[model samples]
Target: MIDILYFAWLRERIGHGRERLETTAPTVAALVEELRARDERHALAFADIAALRVAVDQELTDFDAPLKGAREVAFFPPMTGG
Candidate 1:
């Protein structure tokens, strides 16, 4: 099982902050596809992949990042500075 965390509007849209699930996805993008298939809330939250940033095990990574042995994955909007 892997811990999936959603932040900011993602959390709001998904109606929760985190979840733990077992998956056979090999990469973050594949995991996203699985999430999008789970429910409307998950689909909506991941609708725009370009608007999101991802982190694996607390380290920022791209959508194609491998999930082998990963324990946590986080999704959030890109940080902006004024």
Candidate 2:
């Protein structure tokens, strides 16, 4: 199983902060597609991937990043300087 973490508005929209689940996705994008199929909350949280940033194993990466052997994934909006 892989741990998925949501931050900021993502967490608010999904109604939770994190989850652990087994998946057959080969890449982050594929995992997103699977999540979007789960329910309205997931779909809404993932509706605009362009507005989000992803981290695989705590390292920032593109959505096309491979998920092989990955233990965790995190999603959040891009950080901006104040």
Candidate 3:
């Protein structure tokens, strides 16, 4: 199982901050597809891939990044500079 963490609006949208998931996804994009299929809340949260930023094992990564042995994945909005 992998820990999936949602931050900010994502957390609110999904109605939770984190979850442990058991999935066969090979990449971040695949993992997203799995989550999006879960329910409306998940689908809506992942509706705009471009608006999201992902981290694997606490290190920023792209959606196409592999998830072979990742222990944690985090989703949040892109950081904006003032």
Candidate 4:
């Protein structure tokens, strides 16, 4: 199972914080397609990919990043360091 975490507006839109998922996705993009197909909430949360940032195993990564052996993936708005 893979752990998926949602932060900020993503968590609010999806109505949850995190979840354990059994998936066949090989990449983050594929996982997004699966989630986007789940419901309106997920679609809304992922609607603007450009407004989001992702991390795999706690390291920032692209949506095309390989998910092989991934234990956790997090989605959040871009962090601004001031």
lDDT score at residue 70, model 1, on the 0-100 scale? 100
lDDT scores of the candidates, listed in order: 0.99, 0.99, 0.98, 0.97
lDDT by residue for model 1 (5-76), tens: 999999999999999999999999999999999999999999999999999999999999999999999999
Query: Which ranges of candidate 4 are over 4 A from the true structure?
Result: none
Worst 10 residues of 4 by lDDT: 44-53
Candidate 1: C-alpha lDDT: 0.99
Q: Per-residue alpha-carbon lDDT of model 4 for 1-82, expressed as tens digits? A: 9999999999999999999999999999999999999999999999989999999999999999999999999999999999
Q: Could you tell me the TM-score of candidate 1?
A: 0.99
Screening candidate 2 with a backbone cut-off below 3 angstroms (N, C-alpha, C), the clashing residue pairs are none
- Candidate 3, 1-82: lDDT as tens digits: 9999999999999999999989999999999999999999999999999999999999999999999999999999999999
lDDT of 2 at 52: 98
Summarize candidate 2's per-residue lDDT along 17-74 as a digit string, tens digits.
9999999899999999999999999999999999999999999999999999999999
RMSD (Å) per prediction: 0.4, 0.4, 0.6, 0.6
